[model samples]
Target: MQETHDINIIAWWGALLSTFLALVKLWELWNDRFRIDIGYNFTGAPDIGNEIFVRNLSSKPIILSYWELLYGSGKWPFRKLEEIESPGPDACDIRIDPHSSKTFTFAEENYFDWGLKTLKGRKIYMRLYVAGRRPVVKKLYG
Candidate 1:
């Protein structure tokens, strides 16, 4: 009788462990369901100039708090950084509905004026902050 009781307790623990792991996996999936996609092009069009595209791939709407441009200096092992945040109250006003995208257009001269050319060919990255979630960062390569 004691042997049977021990076997039952072991089985109960095994089942409990499996259930906990499954719940953990479900939590990860839930967290990853909402995603934001970002892309940019530096080649200026005659009419539109350069553009950055922000897309929402989830089923829920998302509010953007702000964004920043990041560039680095120095070699691989040790590097310094500089950041240029989006200016004005408009930066915090962006919102994207589910399965939609928004394009931000700016002139080439504006890029130069923004001081992005100081590093000359250095790679740039964009960091976006969304309300109630971690920030997303991506390389700005065309």
Candidate 2:
């Protein structure tokens, strides 16, 4: 009888330890999932054409997969101003370290080629997406 009771107690302790270990592991995994910091600056319109520079200032590296530019206009339906192709493998993988910044030059010619006109004096919105993470959205009126 005593031996049986000892075995039961050992089994109970083992189950409890396993549960605790699993909880700790879950917490650690949740903590390391993903973290990001984003910053936006509206550089004045480009002199040569209607272009702007979007700067990313953050400590951790953010993998920007793609971005979209939209104009806020009141009408039957909102229109898409421009859709810039995300610089893929050829484009440098942006990794901004602490107190570091990266500049993305958006030119007007590219938009014109895509049948988009000047965005001057228009409210443009930018949406940036990173893989396996939430998108960082911003609105700029320049």
RMSD of each: 5.2, 7.6
- Residue 128 alpha-carbon offset, candidate 2, angstroms: 1.9
Best by lDDT: 1
Candidate 2 per-residue lDDT, tens place, 1-142, comes to 9999999999999999999999999987776544443344433443333343444443345566666656644433664455443454465445544444455555554332212365545545666676557776566553
- Local distance difference test, candidate 1: 0.73
Q: Mark the 10 consecutive residues where model 2 has the least summed lDDT.
A: 107-116
Q: Which parts of model 2 have CA positions greater than 4 angstroms off?
A: 39-62, 69-91, 97-125, 131-142
Q: lDDT of each model, Cα atoms only?
A: 0.73, 0.55
Q: How close is candidate 2 to the true structure, as a TM-score?
A: 0.45
Report the lDDT of model 2 for residue 75: 37
| Candidate 1: regions farther than 4 A off | 1-32, 44-47, 73-79, 112-121
Model 2 residue 65 CA deviation (Å) reads: 4.0
What is the Å distance of residue 138 in model 1 from its true position?
1.1
Backbone atom clashes (below 3 Å) for every candidate:
0, 0
